[model samples]
Target: MDAGAAIWEYLGADAPVADLPAMGYGEVASGYATTHSAESVGIIGGGYVGIETAEAFAEHGLDVHLFEMVPHTLQPFGAEAAATVEDHLRKQGIDLHLDTAVEGIDGAGSVERIGTGDHTVPVDLALVGVGVAPNTELAEAAGIELGTTGAIANDRYGQTNDDQVYTARDCAEATHTVTGEPDHVPLALTANRAGRAIGATLAGDPTPIGEIAGTAAVKAFDLEVARTGVIDEESAAEAGFDPVSVTITAQSRAHYYPGGEEIQITLVADRESERVLGASMVGREGVAKRIDTVAAALHAEMTVHQLSYLDLAYAPSFSPVWDPVLTATKVLHGKVAG
Candidate 1:
């Protein structure tokens, strides 16, 4: 994919594409095996791939510097959650530069340094974790229509603009369950689900796929972070709702439990309808599994008030009598009612 050159060109780097090492995901491990002795490494992009790769290199005792064009890493997560992760990464000795773009990758022959607008950082290895672009060349050649997201436009049954053509996975867009708008989220589960629906439809069973909530999770060092549905303030408003959110920090288990850990949960709801819209959580433990509870609420269109009373299991080893998810929902329910 020549990712490094692609990013350099995208950022208006003076170097030619052929001059850079320009490796893709498949090439990263082999590249690293040869370059592991390098003292420092720089990564472009602060999204999931970049963040995970940076953590890997840093854990191996190499100096790691990460660059993000956006004001924060993990833009899919709300600002507050992203800030929490950024803080944790910094504490792990990762040098993160937010709101910064990689202007160039420079060296005589092999990679040596990465340039931001104001300064340059010396590096033995540079990785480009910027997002991928789908290869729709064959589809375009066949005159298949591309959606606004630049992916092949497909219906619920995975049929494209042309009845004879069908698309799925990273090359196709799916309907957003909340916004009722076409979205191009390339996640493994969504792809697998969509493929099953498409297969059924092709076999004449005609099973139409339901829309997606964009649920996902990731681990940053010891912190578990997860989010589901529409967590962005602007996105909720754009989807035609007045959104209100509440964040609460509570114990993962009984307060007196010896091994209890602090869990932070954020719940977003529509002020008018009071329906739970989205959720984000960050904690040392119990963060990954809790997002599913919120995801189920979003799928069922349950209101924040209803979520507060869900029949969630509670034991000293598991959760408090008032689960963190319930606590956030209960608090937001009050705000929405007030």
Candidate 2:
């Protein structure tokens, strides 16, 4: 919905909009929601939402062009992971335009072309998935205070500044476990958990929700991309850690296993404390669940060295003797110790 509004705002005209209903960020947009068809389509933003939407349209037989203002897509997952997905997208026939911005949209009654200041791509439809903002109008109208994130100021119990008012879901603020600062992540799981905690609190049980690591997963073509905690160098630094990271490619199963798959793991840790700050993975299989394991480690405040020694399950058909997570941690342990 936010993405659709941005497209109309950029075009400066009211145009027919098409909504794509997707389950989470990874799943392809369901075809049931698409009421119209186009020969060519333009997508702005190269993040998870944009990438999935682009793939969905292309699969429906439309020529799709994607634009990203940054040098690459999937910025949240960092550069190397972005490069991996970029290679896959190009191979899948997506016309990618990185380091590019959509300056305007031109058409008569609907979208026809997308302008990028220097160049234009002819398209029958355009989709914008840049980002979303908190819906704070009602809170503002009620005179409830908002945090620096522009989200409704709420305590751990999900109570707004006014004792009688409360906010949750996309409009509420939650604390980041590592940074210890309020952040508005607005993910589905976060909202659901926060709602549960708030319900418990209102019932007089007073269960406070713990801080979150902002974990997420997305599927790009055949690749399962997942990240947990703080993988971005800048975010890690801002959280008061001198970040060191290492990326390694390892097998998902035993070396001799017939169906073994390649898994890429990037581990980030603090140079001084050696604590594991975050991790990301991209693979054909076994990516999403592994990221959850890393998220649990982050919640428990485990160090990279500790993760390297974790007694993870191992089987010929499931994981290597040293799981990819442990393997990456072992390599990261050396770097942090050195």
Badly placed stretches (over 4 Å) of model 2 are: 1-37
Pairs that clash in candidate 1: none
Q: Write the per-residue lDDT of candidate 2 for residues 276-313, one digit (tens) a residue.
A: 99988999889988998899899888999888878899
lDDT of 2 at 290: 90
Q: Give TM-scores for every candidate, taking all chains together and pairing residue i with residue i.
A: 0.89, 0.88
Q: lDDT per residue, candidate 1, 215-286, as tens digits?
A: 898888888889998988999999899999988899998988888888888889999999989989999999
* TM-score of model number 1: 0.89
Off by over 4 Å in 1: 1-36
* Model 2 per-residue lDDT at 10: 38
Lowest summed lDDT over 10 consecutive residues: which window, candidate 2? 24-33
lDDT score of residue 33 within candidate 1:
47
